[model samples]
Structure formats: C-alpha cells, structure tokens
Target: MAQGTLEVVLINAKGLENTDFLNNMDPYVIVCYGSQKRKSSIASGQGSEPEWNETFTFDVNLGDLVSPLRFWTAIVVQRMTVLEKLCNIPLESVMEEGKVPAAPYNVVKDQEFRGQIKVSLSFTHKTHRHGHGMAVQEESYGGWKQSSTY
Candidate 1:
C-alpha cells in the first residue's frame, strides 16, 4: 500500500468547451480520491479559460494495487453523462524525485480532447510505525528468541 500526503495544484485551463451559450460558463472543478472529494472555487464568467491556482490535499492510504491517479471531469450535453480518465501515476517516482512540476493534462469530454489544465503534484510519505513492519528480534529472559514489533 502507498501511504503519504498528496498535494495537488490546480492551475489554469484553456480551450475548454463553452457550456453556456449566451454567457460564459462559470466553471469549477471537483477532484476526487477514493471516497474523499474536494472542489475548487468557481471561476465566475471565465468560461472556457479559467484560472484557479488552487491547492488541495488528500490523505493517501491506498493498497499496493492502487496506482497514482490523474483525474478529469466534463459534461457532454449530447450524452448527458460524465466521463473520467484513469492512469497510474508513478508514486515512487514522485516520492524519489519530489514534486512534479506544473504540467498540462488534457481536459477530456466523452473521450474527446476539449482543453488542457496545468497541474502539479507533490507527495509526502507518512512515517510508518515500527519501521513499516521490519522485524525486531529480542531475547526473552527465558533465553528464547522472539520476533516482535512495537
């Protein structure tokens, strides 16, 4: 399992689909991880191009099979449905190298490229208890050796 604190920088998005016909769409973002969710403030009247420059944090306690996530959300008026993208992030890579620099990720809708949002990620690993399960051998008063963890 991966354990750490994750920091996300919600930068700016460009070339988004203008959902509003007459007025610019007041756009916002909802970021989700597992059962937890976080939302960014609406960029009022920003329409297709919006800048948030927001930061969000998530507690990471994922299983070994869990991979880092890159998330996107958009509405398809034609389909009246929401879509998502799932790709593993190199958690070890981020942990080893430090923060991921600001980069553009595709804003997709129904699998079509709508725009791109610039984001950065940083991971702070949670200090595991008992050396994350490393064995500590101790000799008992009875002279028996035992493996124990505190």
Candidate 2:
C-alpha cells in the first residue's frame, strides 16, 4: 500500500438546476474519499453558475493502487433541506494525466438529471527518503539568498 495526498480544486459550476422555489439557490459542494469528507463555501445566490475557487486536501491510502473519490453538491434551503448529487468524478484519470479535465458533471435529483457541475482533480504522491550520515546542504531563494552546509 502507498500513501499520498489527493488535491481537489473546486473551481466553479454552471447550468445548475435551482432547487429553491422562491429565490436563487445557494449551492455548496461535498467531496468524499473513503471516510473523509470536505465541503466548499456556499456560492450565495450564484444559483446556476457558482464559482468556488477553493482547494481541499485528503490523505489517501492506495491498496492495489486504486483511489476512491467522489463529489456531490447541495443547496441550502431552510437549513440544509435541499440536496442534489453531482456525478462521481474519477481520480484515476487525474493520476495518469496530472490533472483531470474540468468537465461538466451531471447533477441529479430524485434519480433525474437536474444540471451540471464542473470541477478539476489532482493527485500527488508523498516520497520518503532515508538520510543517514550524509552532508546536508541547504539553500534559500526569494526575498534573501542564503546557503548553509553541515
């Protein structure tokens, strides 16, 4: 098994079907990987075209080298009553291509197509190195330049 970090950038969504009857819907996203879950900020009246521009991170364990990730969106109507599900965005494509295409995902409500949400996904592996009795050289960049050897 290998451990890594899954990075999700919630860019925006468009053509979302508004669930609110009286006003424009305030939509937010719910991302899940295994038992972990994260949420994006509400778009707040953006309704059909909501822009999040937020980033979320999740620690993942790959068994048989597979990732389990999914995304969903919901609109807050009278204290979180309205719920809508976006499509399950795959992570394997991101792992192979560095970044997944920001494509529109089908949104569903009551097992019916409602709208679409666009998003991008990325994955990075954590590397471990053993440094024992080796000379350490460090360098600094930007603002001020510095170097040290030990």
Candidate 3:
C-alpha cells in the first residue's frame, strides 16, 4: 500500500450558530480520522468565531480503501450536539498539488447553511517498503490507535 502523510490546518470558523445564550460558546473541534480522534482546546469567549491556528498530522495510505485518513469533522455545540456539516474535500487535489490552501467551507445543519469553517490540507507521499525486516510505528490519538500487524 502506498503510504504518505496528511497535514490538516484548523484555521478558524466564522458566522457560527451561537448555541450558548448566556455567554459566548466555548467551541472546540473533535477531529476524527477513522478510529483516532483529537480534541482541540476551547476558544474560551471567542463566541461565534473561534481561531485555533493549530495543525494536525495523520498518516495516510492511498492503497487502503478505509484508511485512517478518512476523517469527518464535527464541531460540537454545547459539547453535546452535532454541529458538523458535510463538506466534500477532494483528495485528488492533495495527490496532484500536494496541498490545499486555507479556505472556508460551508457549515450546515438540517440542510440549512449555518456558517463557514476555514481549513487547509496537505499530503506528503512516503515510500512504503516491504521486507522481512520492517517496522511501523503508530501514535495514539486520545487513547485510540490504529491496529497494524507486521
């Protein structure tokens, strides 16, 4: 299987639906790529627009049909409700250009457009070697790890 790396930049979000009425929403992202998930730090009183400016990296396999890189992001509202919107991110762009510049993607709920979130992605092709003596190291995400056997 062809292996590589996928870099995700969690830029910021704007015009989000304020789920918190008493105070500004304490928004954070639960980034899930397959079984592994990473939780971002709360934006505090940032309210409708939260800027994380954080970067996350994940290993990807072009040959795996269901690689861990298959992540669907969901913005949690009140840390309970699913404020995630379905957005199509073309993996092909990463294959060709190797990077997707930071841009805004529409955020929706119940088929209604609610807001936008900006993100950027990049891919680095890594050579995979198969030999009798080989090793693969894995990282744990929030206690979740990708199962692999040598």
Point out where model 1 deviates above 4 Å.
67-92, 129-150
Rank list by lDDT? 2, 3, 1
Model number with the top lDDT: 2
lDDT by residue for model 1 (77-150), tens:
34353434422244555554548899887665567877787788887766544576653332223323345545
Extract clashing residue pairs from model 1. none
- The local distance difference test score of model 2 is 0.72
Tell me the deviation in Å of residue 96 in model 1: 4.5
Backbone clash count, each prediction separately: 0, 0, 0
Task: Give candidates' CA RMSD values in order.
Answer: 8.6, 8.4, 8.6
Q: Candidate 2 regions off by >4 Å?
A: 108-112, 131-150
Give one digit per residue, the lDDT tens place, for model 3 in 15-132: 8887678777777776666556667677878888889999888777654353433323444455565545435455666655778899888877688987787888887767444466
RMSD of 3: 8.6
User: For candidate 3, what is the TM-score?
Assistant: 0.71
- What TM-score against the true fold does each predicted structure earn? 0.69, 0.77, 0.71
Would you list the C-alpha lDDT of every candidate in the order shown? Answer: 0.66, 0.72, 0.67
Compared with the true structure, the alpha-carbon lDDT of candidate 3 equals 0.67
| Residue 39, model 3: Cα distance from true site in angstroms | 1.6
